[model samples]
Target: MQKVIIFTDGACKGNPGRGGIGYYLISDAGKTLKGSKSYLRTTSSRMELMAAIEALRLLKFPCKVELYTDSRYLADSVNKGWLNTWLASPFFLNRKNEDLWRRLANEMQKHQVSIHWVKGHSEQAQHRLVDRLASRACNSPKPLIDPGYFFKI
Candidate 1:
């Protein structure tokens, strides 16, 4: 079986205004699936978490996955097991993006996944692709961009 690799990034226009999550998924045999979507009244961090959530959800069955992301908040939370500690503490009650973190935790339980923090805007071409997709989405409000918007992707 082929390994599953996912590259993700999130873009925000105004921090608390609109944001987008971009994900690039590729299988070991060269098959690929990738897209980005914009969300109203969302933060980049939320979208960062959402990108991973949506990317993992693409799998019909669990497999070994290497998820690459530019956001340290997303990577460190999962890879360092900070999410576990948060879930057990009252601090999680007031933590930002708790809902997404919980959802991420649930999605993670279903697969053999590892989160890797990749430096933003480096030599990785795929990262640039995801960044472009996400930024494009963040620049709009539908119809003018694409009909399906990203629901189809």
Candidate 2:
């Protein structure tokens, strides 16, 4: 399987304000892809999860993915078995960011994924780059509407 490494970050102007998600993807074949999108209104957690979902969605075929994020909510959900517990539970309506979680879960099944947690604003260049990208995205003038945040879908 093709091996790929992804670094993701999310930035929010305020807790429930403008948010953005960023991701950087590098493949074993020396290919690179990067993206950032700003949402009109959302939470940091939603942006974090969206980063992973968007990154995985970009892949054209199934591959081995090493997804790195600075958010504990994102990393711990997968690493600490919280995602499986949530999926198995019937109380999905009570879960926060259930829409993004379900969307992320669907994208994850398309590949072999491993989620890694990294310290925010770390010395790593890739991590810092993604951080900057996310920050910039949130500050963009033309932000897109976040339906999930507005409609709670």
Candidate 3:
């Protein structure tokens, strides 16, 4: 099976403020496929989840994907299996970032995806690229949208 490597990162000006998500897609042979970054007026967690979701959507074909991100909340929640239990519950009963989590879980069901936790601002080339892209997205003049619909003040 063919493999795709994805590097993702999210940044927020504040814990619950303007944010941006970034990703870099590369083939197993080290060919750069694509790069994307998006801005949002939401929390770091939402951007983190959005980064993964957007990366998956960017893929044109089904392939084995290894997605790397700096957020342990995102990586562990999906990879360590908290998504299933969160989905089974209704009314959002104390769940955090429900909208982003649900969106991520839905997108995850559509592809062969794996999550890897990487150290932020490390020596990884792709990770640095994602950071630069995310910073650009955050500083760009693009209008931001609220991604965390379920998040209360």
Per lDDT, the best of the predicted structures is: 2
Q: What's the CA error at residue 50 for candidate 1, in Å?
A: 0.8
Residues 31-78, model 2: lDDT tens digits:
999999999888888899988999999999999999999999999999
- Candidate 1 runs further than 4 Å off: 143-153
Worst 10 residues of 3 by lDDT: 144-153
lDDT of each: 0.82, 0.92, 0.78
Q: Which has the higher lDDT value, candidate number 1 or candidate number 2?
A: 2
TM-score of each: 0.88, 0.97, 0.87
The whole-model C-alpha lDDT of candidate 1 against the native structure comes to 0.82
Q: In candidate 1, list every pair of residues with a backbone clash.
A: none
Q: List clash counts for every candidate, in order.
A: 0, 0, 0
- Residue 146, candidate 1: alpha-carbon lDDT: 22
Lowest summed lDDT window (length 10), candidate 2: 144-153
* Candidate that would win on TM-score: 2
* Residue lDDT tens for model 1, 35-54: 88888767778778888988
